[model samples]
Target: MDVSIILILLLAGTLVTLFSGKAAGKVALAFGLLALGASVALLTKFNAHQNIGCLGVWMENPQIYFALNGDGLSLAMVLLTTSLLPIIMYSTFGSEVKNPSSFYALILFMGFAMVGTFLAADGFLYYIFWELALIPIYFIALNWGNGDAKERQKAVVKFFIYTFAGSLFMLASFAYLYTKAGNFLIGNLSALSLSADEQFWIFLGFFAAYAIKIPLIPFHTWQAAVYQKAPTAGTMLLSGIMLKMGLYSVLRWQLPIAPYAAKTFMTIFIVFGIAGTIYGSIVALRQKDLKKLLAYSSLAHVGLIAAGAYTLTVDGLRGAVLQMISHGFVIVGLFFAAEVIFRRYQTREISEMGGIRVQAPKFTSMFMILVLASVALPSTFNFVGEFTVLYGLSSINIWFPILGGLTIILGAYYMLKMFQNVMLGEANPKPFADITFQEGLTMGVIIAVLFFFGLYPKPIVDMITPSIEQILSYTHKL
Candidate 1:
C-alpha cells in the first residue's frame, strides 16, 4: 500500500467532516483508526537496514526529490504520532465545540501534516509539512480558546509569530546547506562537510529555530499564556505532540549534519538547556494557575530532553527519544486532569480549590499518579528517561549531571505543591464533582501506559538504541 494514501485519507476525512455535522466525530474516529492501523502496518514492513527512497522528483533539482523513508528513528516518531491521534480525538468527544465538523476537520488535517513531518525525507518537503502542522492548531486555538477574545487572539498571534520567526532561520539554515551540498535530501546533507565557522553559524540557525519551538528559556514567554488560554484539545496537541518536533529535529538535522560545530558548541547549548530546566521550574513554582504550571513544567522536562540529545552519546540520544514519548503521555494526563478540575469548578486558580481528594478519591488518585510520573518517581517511565539522560551527561561533565539532577527536587516540590493545593487542603466553600467515566477512562489509559512502560522500558530502549547507534556512527565519521 502506498504511504501517500495516508495523506489522501486525511484530506478526504477533513472534507467529509466539514460537510457532515453529527457524523463528523465518527468519521474522524474511523480515519484516525485507519491511519493508526496503516502506520502500524508500515512499521511492521519497515526494513531497518534501508533508510532512503524517492517517491518521485518534485522539481528540476535532484535535491528536491519527493520521498518517504523511515528507519528506526522515524518509525518510532511515526508510531507515536499515529497512536496518540485516536486518543486525542476520543478525548474530544462531547466537547464544547459548536462547529464540530470544522473542529474535527482541522484535527484530521493536522494529523496529515504531522505524519508528513515524521516521514518526509527531503529538507524542503519536510519544512513545508513542518509549517503546515502549525496552521490548524493556530485556528483551533484562536477560535475555540477560553478567556477574553482579545487575550486569546493576542496569545495565538504571539505563538504564531514566535514560531514562524524561528522557522525562517531554519529555512535559511537549510538553504545554506543546500548551497554547499546542492541537494535537499537529509541523507546527502549529512554526508557533506563544512568548515567549523560555517558549521557554527548553521548550527546556530538550526538551534535558534528549535530552541524557540521547544520554547527554551528566554524563548518561552509565549507558551504558558497560549497553553492556559487555548482549548483543552488544542493544548493537548500543542504540548503533547507538537513540542516533540523541535527535539526530534535536533537529532535528525542539527547534531548529525554539523558534528564539528555541535562538538564545539555543545557546552553552550547544554547550558541553555540547563537554564531552561531551572528557569521553567522556578517560574512554575510561582504560578497560581494549574494549566500555566503544567505548561512551565513541560518546558522544563523538554529542556532535559534537549540537553540529552546534545550530549551526543547513544544513551543520551536514546533517553531523549524515550523521554519525548514519556513526556507526551505525562503532559496529556496532566492537562486532562486540569480540564476535569476546571469543568467542575469553572476555575484554574490553585487557591480556589481545596480538599479535592476528600471529595474525589478516584480523580485524586489518578492525578497523584500523573504527578509522580512527571516528577520522575522510581518505577515511572519518566525515571527511566531521566536516569539514562543523567548517566549520559555524567560522561560529558561531572558538574552537568549534578546540576541537572537538581530538577528532581524542583520537580517534586512544584508538582506536589500543586497537587496538595488542589487535592489535599481544606475543602472549598464551593463544591466540586468527581471525575466522569470518560475522563477517568482517558486518564486511566495514560497512567497504565506510563506504569507499564516505566517498569518495563526495555522494549522502547531496544527499538531506539539502534537508531541512536546509527546517529552516533555518523557523528564519529564526521
Candidate 2:
C-alpha cells in the first residue's frame, strides 16, 4: 500500500508502452487505470489510519531521501493526477498519432513525474520529479502539437524556458533552506526559524516559480499559446493536472517554510490572483479559437483558486483544494470537446464550428454539462468549489468576493457565448460525426465525477481539512 506504487505503475506503463508499438495507447490506458485503482485502494486504507508512505536515503551528503508520503493533501492531488491520465490517454483514441510508442511513453512518463511530485516528502526529491514532469510535456507539445510547426515550436520553447527558469528559483530557495535546516525533508524545512528578511527572499524565490507555474496574471503570458499549440492530451495535462503542481507546492512547501513572509505578502498576491481572474475571463470572451478560449477560461479558474489559497483561511484552503480537483476534470472535458470539433472540421476556430448539437446529441449533452459546470451552475461539482472559494473570499472582505465573483459572471457569459456559437444554430452540413464510444466514455466519466462530487463533497472535504489546518498552523505563526 505504499504510495510509491503509483509511481512504479506509471514508470512500468511507460516502459511497457514504449515497446508496445501499435498498442501503446491501449497499454497506457490500462496502466493508467491500474494507477488510479492503486490510489483508490490507498485512500481507503488511509482513512483507516494506516501508513502508506516509504522513506530511504537517496543521497548522503545533501541528505536527500527517496521519501514518499500520502498525507490526505498529497493523496488528493495524487488522485487527481491518476484519475486524469487514463482519460487523457483515451481521449486520443481517434487521432492518428505518429510514433504512438514515443507519444504514449511520454504521457505515462509525465504521469510518473507528476505522481512523484505529489508524493515526494523530501524537498530535493520533489524538485527532481517536478522538473522531470516538464521534459515529456515539452516534447509532447513541440512534436505532437497542432498549428504551424515554427509557431508551435516557439510557444513550446517559451513554456519550457519559462517553467524551467522559474523552477531554478525554487531550486535555489531549496538550496538555501538546506543550508539552514541541514536536510531537505518537509518537516525539517517547515520547522526552520528564519529572519523576516530571510523569509522574504525565500518566499519570493518560491513565489517566482509558483506564480509562473500557476501563471498568475503577469506570468500567464506563456499559457494561451502553449495550450493552443499542444495536442489535446498535452493540453489536458497542462491545464488539468500540471497547473496544480504550483498550487500544491504553495501549500506543501512554500508557505510552511516561509510563514512570516506568506502572511506579510498575502494581500499583494491575493490581488494578483483576483486580477488574473478578471483579466482571463475578459480575454476568454474575446478568443476566436476554441482551445485559446478554454485556455483563458482555465486561466480564470486557476486565478481564483490561487487567490483562495493565498487567503490562508480554512474556507480558503478547503475551497482551493476542492476547486483544483473539479477544475482538473472540467478542463480536460472542455479540451476534449475542442479536439472532437477539430477532428471533424479541421479547425480550432469558433466561427468555423456550429450545429454540432443538431448532429451529435450525446456530445452535445455531455459538452453542455461541461459548459454549465464551468459556469458553476448549481449541483455541478464546479458550483460547490466556486461557492466555497467565493465564501472564503467574502470571509476576508466584501470586496474579495465581489471582484473574484466576476469570474463566475464573466465566465458564464464567455462560456455560454462560445457554446452557443460552437454547438448551437444551423448544422454546418460538413458532416459532423457523433463521438465514438471511446470519446463518449471519457466525457461520461468526467461528467459523472462532477455530478457525484457536486452532490457529496463531504468525503474529500473531510480528507483535506486536517491537512489544511496543519498548513494554517504554520502560516498563523506570523
Listed per candidate, the RMSD to the true structure in angstroms reads 1.6, 1.1
TM-score of 1: 0.96
Write the residue-wise lDDT of candidate 1 on 318-381 in tens digits: 8889899999889998988898888888999998988988789998999999999999998999
C-alpha positional error of residue 57 in candidate 2 after TM-score superposition, expressed in Å: 1.1
Each model's lDDT: 0.86, 0.92
Cα error, candidate 1, residue 300 (Å):
0.7
Over 4 Å off, model 1: 2-5, 51-54, 61-63
lDDT of 1: 0.86
Considering summed lDDT, which 10 consecutive residues are worst modelled in model 2?
43-52
Total backbone collisions for each predicted model: 0, 0
What is the C-alpha lDDT profile of model 2 across 220-318, one tens digit per residue?
999999999899999999999999999999998888989998888888989999999999999988899999999999999999999999898999889
TM-score of each: 0.96, 0.98
The per-residue C-alpha lDDT of model 2 at residue 118 equals: 91
Q: How much is the lDDT of residue 196 in candidate 2?
A: 97
